[model samples]
Target chain A: MSLSENLFYFLSFLAIFSALMVVFAKNPIHSVLYLILVFFALTGHYILLNAQFLAIVNIIVYAGAIMVLFLFVIMFLNLKKEGDISAKSVFVKVAGVVSGGLLLLVMIASLKSLEPYQLKADIKTDIGLVENLGKVLYNDFLLPFELASILFLAAMVGAVMLGKRESGERNF
Target chain B: MVEIITKIPLEYYIILASVLFCIGVIGVLIRRNALIIFMCVELMLNAVNMLFIAFSAYRGDASGQVFVFFIMAVAAAEVAVGLAIIVMIYRNTRSVDVGELNKLRY
Candidate 1:
């Protein structure tokens, strides 16, 4: 009945639709584009929740950086629709859909039945602000934050190692 | 505390994220392209991230949102490595279809 409610529903529909399109798009490039749309919708939801920092981070990290990485790879591969396996079984697809639907039903039925928690009057809304989050990150989560940098270093090394070709190998 | 109120129930976000996650699962199961499957995994991660953010905002707790920050960090690292692995596989097999990569099927 309010603008926020309307925005929520609209973003929800956009996200779900774009997600499905990401799966079913005939071209991998199209799939990547659809995925970007999904990320944008999720960013909109983050803003609606009033997590301004997360909203900006979501858009920058997800839509701007990560999706660009995906698009670069898809284009580098030059993957065509015909490059996909031509004779995929209908049964495998049906089974995947049915199994996923079952999981969705179970999760929603179990989780949605619980009563939603009401926000308290004295709740700390400013916690989502960058200043407060930076304090928490620097103070409480310092160890994990440092460890994540190590993880990034390892990932970078692994990617370089995996991507480089052997000295004697010929291009196929 | 900013006076902005999210009157939409957490249940809606939960359901929306659930549906998004399931779509991702289905995409991974049915898609043969390694890159598409990779994107689906990202989709699932985003879905979970949304739930974390929703909970964090509603409870006025910063921990959950901080956890989401860690998730995005890990996801960034993950994508770098995963795409490289897929490229290696493509170079080796000359194809990116998961069905054709049967070397590990033992």
Candidate 2:
């Protein structure tokens, strides 16, 4: 195996392991930390794919911002003891695992039939660079870019409104 | 770089992403904490992103990378609103457990 293939296997292992940890960790904070590790492993995969811009953005947006938000919420809630938080019935747990395993098997079977093809000659190599990506973003995707900003604005307003403590009579 | 990338078959990525997505699904189904479930959803999104970037590089197309950008933006917005809702739930219910918040399940 070449160096690149080795790197890919290592990164995939890290990502899968950390993702499992995120699910099984007793403390919510530990889950958040494991999620961060998964993101870092994903960033490594992005880099291996020659997507430098995406790798950096993944680090900045996911690991830097979103996870910190998660950590803040976990800490603010002060969930010191997470006793018996998962489902109690053994049947439900078994059913969930069975369903998820079935889904994985189906997806793998479908992907196994795909034929690998050689890269096309017209394929551009520098597209993953920041300059080329920026050109396409501003020139071809200008409208969607603006729309995304609007979406962010709406989300910010909605979050603030939902989180504001009520002072008047409660209406449930 | 593209040649080196194509040396590894795309099917490997497909398998990796499928596993990650299933892990996310199992996490959502089995875990009771709303915050942990939300994190699992993010995990699923990352799996999709990895697939997108892999295909984009394989095809030598930049559009898939751009799509990943949009996915990231949407994820950020979703997390903002979702976490705020989770915090509100905690304030009113004194717990982050989803099983206990069934007041609307009449």
Candidate 3:
């Protein structure tokens, strides 16, 4: 009945629709585009939840950086062939959808008993603010925060190694 | 004295995330393209992240948001490495389809 609730439903619809399109699109590039829309809808949800920092990060990392990388890969591969549309058998596709639907049914049924969790009286409501989370990230999660740099370094080196062409490779 | 987020129940979010996750699973199962499967995995990760954020907001805990941040970092690292591996496979096999690659030695 409220404006925020309306926005929430609209965004949820947008996200769900885009996600389905991402799976059903024949071209990988189209899928990437649809995925960007999905990420944008998620960002809207984050904003609605008042997680301002997470909202920005979701847009920057997912919609901006990751989707761009996916687009680049798709373009390089030129995977617009029609043959991919029929990649799986009809029976396999039906089974996949049926199993996925069963999983959804089970999760929703189990979630029906979830007791509502209220915010503690003493808990600060502004915990999602960048200032607060940054403080907590450095203070309590300092070790893990610092260690992520190592993970990034390893990933960078590994990507480079895996992507590089060997001597006399004759192919990229 | 809690900041009421919206009229929407937290269950709605949980259900939304679950549906997104199921869509990702179905995509992984039905799609033979390694790239599509990888994108579906990203979708699943995002579903979990959104759920985490919802819980964080509802419970007024910063830890959940911090965990989501860490998950994003790990996802970025994973995408970099996974895409590189996919590229190498594509280079050798000339196709990104998982069904075509039957042999482990290739």
Q: Interface RMSD, candidate 1?
A: 1.8
Q: What is the TM-score of chain B in candidate 1?
A: 0.93
Better model by TM-score: candidate 1 vs candidate 3: 1
Off by over 4 Å in 2: A84-86, A169-172, B1-3
Candidate 2, residue A6: lDDT: 86
Q: Which run of 10 residues does model 1 chain A get worst, by summed lDDT?
A: A79-88
lDDT rank order: 2, 3, 1
Q: Write the per-residue lDDT of candidate 2 for residues B1-106, one digit (tens) a residue.
A: 4455666887888899999999999999988999999999999999999999988988888999999999999999999999999988888777889999888998
* Tens digits of lDDT, candidate 1, A17-39: 99999999988889999999999
lDDT of 3 at A95: 98
**Per-prediction DockQ scores?**
0.69, 0.66, 0.60
Runs with alpha carbons beyond 4 Å of true place in candidate 3:
A84-86, A118-123, A168-172, B1-6
The per-residue C-alpha lDDT of model 1 at residue B14 equals: 87
Better of 2 and 3 by lDDT: 2
How are the candidates ranked when ordered by DockQ, highest leading? 1, 2, 3
